[model samples]
Target: MSGLLALLDDVAAIAKLAAAQLDDVAGQASKAGVKAAGVVIDDAAVTPKYVTGLPAARELPIVWKIARASFFNKLVILLPVALLLNAVLPWLLTPLLMIGGAYLCFEGAEKVWHLIIPQKDHGPQQAETLDAAHLEEQRVKGAIKTDFILSAEIMTISLAQIEIDTLWIQAAALAAVAIGITALVYGAVALLVKADDLGVLLSVKGRLAATRAFGRRIVKSMPAVMLVIATIGTVAMLWVGGSIIVHGVHDLGWHLPYEQIKYAAKVAAETLGAANGFVTWAVTAGLDGVIGLAVGFILIPIVTRVIAPVTGWLFPEKT
Candidate 1:
């Protein structure tokens, strides 16, 4: 009887140890996911446009396909590459993240520029002119390619936040971050895209007058909602990109921009004692966004006039 009691206590202790390790993994994953929230938001924001003119029946299906591809991109490709880079070439992580940050800045600034002066080429309309199946295929392929870059950034950012000494714990944390963020972004995308349909259903089929009115409001508001979401995403990208570059440069031994931003945040925080933390973060993000926008504007002409043409010439389409 005494021997049995000892065995029970030992088993309970082992179970408790496993539970503690699991909690550590969860905590790390949550922290890492927060670090990559900006990219995740941008991904959710960007995906809905892919189904712009598709039939309502096709919207969810298309989102599902893209989500599947995004999962594969993050887990099958970026996750392993992130781990390998961390193990074999940890120093490269900061530089690569800076590159991604620059790209994000460029994209965000490009969107702003487009908002100021709308482009002539309507990609969705042009795609819609082709066969529906072909348009779907092309859109999915393009979305996947774009997602690969964003996924790499997300994975790298998440990995950088993890300071776990255990290899298995690091792996577990990364996997959780990847899976959670993918699900979150795609889930949000799905909801946003299907919102119109939901509204239409509610408006046309609801039994109560109030419910129907609410449905109409949803349908009416969807365009504005999408626009707001896009704007937020762009701002987040710029803020995140600028912050990344600032941190990258600081890590690489140039501390002026980062230190100045922190100083600015500190001054703001001092001005608002009660809300110091929030004020500090808001100030830092605002300054970082400005820097990101400045960098993006600089890159635009160089990318368009030089890089684009060169790349096109070097890698002409096979067809």
Candidate 2:
């Protein structure tokens, strides 16, 4: 009986240790996820547009497919690559991050430029060319390609945030963050896209006046909500991109730009003394975004006139 009691105590201790390890893993994973929040927000914001014009029945399925592709991109392709890079070529991470950051800046600036000067939509011309199935496949493929870049950034950022010492722990943390964020972003997209249908059903079939009114409100506000969400995503992309570049520069031994940005942010905060934290953060982010836009605009001409033609010339297509 005494021997049995000793074994029970030993088992209880082992169980407690297991629980503690699990808690640690969860905590680390959550921390890493939060660190990649900007990328996650941008992901959620961008994905909905892919499904915007699809048939209602197909929207969710397409999102599901892309989400699966995103998973494979992060886990199968990116995770192993990130791990290998961490082990072998840690120095390259900063440059790659800067490349991703530049992409974000370019995209954000392009959107703002488009909004300022409304371009002629040749969308109808292209739409007339492709049948529904072909268009769907093209969009999905395009979305997956885009997801690969974003997923790489997400995994890299998450990997950087992890505090674990072992490669396995780091991998697990990254996987957890990738899975969680993908589910969150795509799940939110699925909801946002189908919300109108749900609202219509609720508004028509709701038993109570309050329920109907709430549904009506949802339906009415959807357009504005979508615009706001899209704007948020763009802003986030710019802010995150600028911040990443700043950090990348610092990592690469060029500290001046980063220090200057931080100093500017501090000064801005001091200028608006005692205001809400949001106000301070907004000021900082806005200034950073302006700086990023300037840099991106400067690069635009160089990229378009110089880089594009050079790449085309270097890689002529096969007949």
Candidate 3:
């Protein structure tokens, strides 16, 4: 009886420890997810457009396909690469993050530029001619490729955010974050894509007046919702990109920009007289976004002419 009691106590202790470790992992994962919010927003925003022209019937299926590819990209490809970098080239993380940030800034700035100076569409009209199946395949491939870049950024950001002692903890945190963000983004996309159809059905077929009214409101709200999401995504990308570059510069011993921004934020906070940390942070982020936009605009032409050609050559398509 004594021996059995001792063994039971030991098992209980082990179970308690395991539960503590899981709690720690979940806490870390949530923190990491919050840290990668910008990339998450961009991922969500970019995905919906890929499904835009597809038939309503095909939308969810395409989203599922892309979501699966995104999982593979994050879990299989980017996760291993992130872990390898954490183990081997840890010093490279900041610079690599800065590069990813620069990409975000470039994307955001290009959007703004297009808005400022609309362009005539003169490129090859290839996709419109593609059959439905081919078009679906192409969109899925494109979305997955885009997801790879964004997922890489998200994983790197999440990895950097984790404050853990062991490799296993870091890995678990990253995996959790990756899976959580993927589910949230794709799940939201599925809902958003299907929302209108659901609304129409309810509006036309609902037996209750309130149901029809609710459906009408949903249909009316969708366009504004998309516009708001796009705007939020763009702003987030620029803000996060700029903040990363600023911090990277500080890490590299250039403190001028970081100091100036901090000072400006403090002044703004004092002027507001009691707004709270969120407002101050928002002000700081807006300033950072302006700086990032300027840097991105400068890089755009360089990227278009030089980087694009080099990347294409180095990564020539397989026959």
Per-residue alpha-carbon lDDT of candidate 2 for residues 1-319, written as tens digits (9 for 90 to 100) = 9999999999999999878777767888899787677778878888887775668899988999999999999889999999999889988877887887887877777778779888898766766787878778877987997899889888877777777767777787878888888989898998998999989988999999998998899999999998888888788777877877778878888999777777776777777787747666776677777766876777677777998799879976442
| TM-score of every candidate relative to the true structure | 0.95, 0.87, 0.93
- Candidates 1 and 3 compared: the better one by TM-score is 1
Model 3 stretches with alpha carbons more than 4 Å out:
1-5, 121-127, 313-319
Give the number of the best model, judged by lDDT.
Answer: 1
Write the residue-wise lDDT of candidate 1 on 139-242 in tens digits. Answer: 78878888889998898888889988677888899899988998899899999998988999999999999999999999999999998899999999999999
Clashing pairs in 2: none
- Candidate 1: global Cα-lDDT? 0.90
lDDT of 3 by residue, 1-319 (tens): 9999999999999999989888888999999899789889888888988886678899999999999998888888888899899899999999999999899899999888888999776323655777778777777888889998899889988888888867888888889998999999999989988989999998999999999999999999999998888889889999988988898899989999999999988988888888758768988898899988987999899999999999999998653
The lDDT of each candidate is 0.90, 0.82, 0.89
**Residue 12 lDDT, candidate 3, scale 0-100:** 100
Runs in model 1 lying further than 4 Å from the true structure: 1-3
Choose 2 or 3, whichever is better by lDDT: 3
| Top-TM-score candidate index | 1
